[model samples]
Target: MEQAELTALLTAQGLRMVDEIGPLATTGEVAAAVSRLRGAGHSPDLVAAVVGQAHLRTRAAAKFGPFADRMLFTRAGLEQATRLEIAARHAARFRDAGLTRVADLGCGIGGDALGFAGIGLDVVAVDADETTAALAAYNLAPFGEAATVRHGLAEDVDLAGVDAVWLDPARRTAGHSETSRTRPEDWSPSLDWVFDLAARMPVGVKLGPGLDRGLIPDDVEAQWISVDGSTIELVLWSGALRRDGVRRSALVVRTGAAHEITAASDADDEPVRELGAFVHEPEGAVIRARLIGDVARELQAGMLGEGIAYLTSDAALTSPFVQSFRVREAMPLKVPTINAALRWNGIGTLEIKKRGVDVDPAQFRRKLTLKGDASATLILTRVGEGKAAQRLALLVDRV
Candidate 1:
């Protein structure tokens, strides 16, 4: 958002009007709301700013819950902002480590800073963007002197007396709605500078889950976290923030519960074996952390194929780390063969799942003329090696 709009949106009158209007879900609804506000003698700029914020808050509710209403956000800030629940977890790491003060470098919209202040830690939240820093200062105003927002480069932030440093380097040049896959070297403050800082202090760096494993430092504890089924972020912990004997970890969060599996070293992979009665799809966090082998050992399962993430075991097992499915039928991967198998089983609706293959599930599912009342998951994956390699379709049911 531009400076003037931001100023207008954060005004007492704008906030009151936004709260009164509530959330506008559709373009038509927004237009209607705008007309009503305009008729009520609200200025055009005020209506536009408040309406936009109201819409963003509605969307932000998924990440911030009720706090979204009180919070101010930029389009990019809301997108990059850490979910409040996840931020609380980050705060706990520092609080448990006996750290009372933290430097939140690149603290967009003060999402993590709010968590730090909420846990009674003194926070110095820094953002490179002036407007974002202003919004952060406004959002964190409730904490009074305990939380402070600064507008500056992360690398230039003074860290004196800060017990811990939290760095979320800007990884994308575009807004949150756009793809933000940038090279490590392109990261603001750069991974080089961030690592150098980590070496000198207790540090926590948040990165994309898909970051190249080779770039990870050996001394830090790397944790991959997935909220629901989506792999969210990879957190690198250094010094006292790093858990004892934990080098790599996968934290899976579902509905109300969370499960974490940690390994001191990369877990050894179980040997590839023939297709079994049950197939387990390891959570995305586990796969990203390269700890799927540990999960396989826990389930007494073997890799579906070398270098493939899918696991198979004859025993029926259920774990929070993997989504287990029961294999009903296996067939050569072909449209005709899959259709025939589905027809034979009276399967009408199919949940197409694919790995280590190029086929688009949605496009491929459209080709099959399904009939009957049954529903089942169809897994497409390659098995075997070299000339013996062949794609197989596994009809499976949730265990």
Candidate 2:
């Protein structure tokens, strides 16, 4: 959002208008809003700001739910903001650790700050971008004295009286609408400085899930979290906030329930075996945290192929950490052979999942003339070792 647009949206009329209009979920609704607002003698800047925020709020509903109706967002800021439920879990860590005051550095639009304050903790939310900070202050206004937002660099923010720190370093270049990812060296406040402070005080750092494991500090607890099967973030916990004897953790939050699997370190991988009655795909968080071995043991399963993450077993049962598929039949990877089988089975709806192949599922789907009423999942993956390795297409049903 530009300064002029932001300025226009800060007025009494603008806020009321946005609240009344709610989310413009479609392009036609947005166009109608823009035309109507502009026709009513409203300035172009106000119309743009209102329309942009309305659309953004519609998109943000997936993350914030109904709370999105009252929030304001910039495209890039909303993209980086943590989900409200995820933020609450982060807040629970601080609360569970007996921390009361927190300094939220790089607080984008006060998402985490709201979480902190919602849990009755005092929060000092700071952001480098003036527009974002202003929006953060606005978003956090509901909390009144519990939340205090400041516009300043994270390194420059005073930490006096704060019990702990919450760091979300800016990982992208400066922008309101569009930004590109920055290298680790280019991160705001720098990881080196952040890690140094974390060593001296209690701190929780939110990072991208794909962060290099080698760079993680030895004393900190590294946790990967997945929401509805999508791996979302990796959080490094230090000092009193770090869970004891849990160096690596995978948290899976589905619906409103949360399940966790924690280990002191990555467990050993199970050996490869022949195809079994069922194949399980480890959840993204479990894969990222490298704790598939733990789940495999629980299900009495083994790797489907060497170095592959797929687990196979004849147990006819599965765990929450994996999506179990009952094997229907295994066929050659050739398109024609598979098409004949699919047609014979009357398969029309296909769900393609691949692990070690170069085939584009969309393009591959186009090659087959799907004309029946049945549905099945196709697993295109390489099985067996070295010279025996072959791309096998397995037809299966979700268990």
lDDT, each prediction: 0.90, 0.92
TM-score of each: 0.96, 0.98
226, model 2: CA deviation in Å? 0.9
Model 2, position 386, has a per-residue lDDT of 73
Candidate 1: pairs in clash: none
Q: Across residues 1-399, which tens digit of lDDT does each residue of candidate 2 receive? A: 999999999999888888888778899999999999899998999999988999999999999899899999999999999999999999999999999999999999888998999899999999999999999999999999899999999999878899999999999999998899999999998999999989999999999999999899999999999999799999999999999999999999988789999999998999888899999999999999999999999999998887778999999788879999999999989999899889889998999998978999999989886869999999999887677778899999999
Instruction: Provide the global lDDT of candidate 2 against the true structure.
Output: 0.92
> Which parts of model 1 are misplaced by more than 4 Å?
174-180
Evaluate model 1: give its lDDT.
Answer: 0.90
Model 2 error, position 27 (Å)? 1.4
For candidate 2, the 10 contiguous residues with the lowest summed lDDT are 382-391
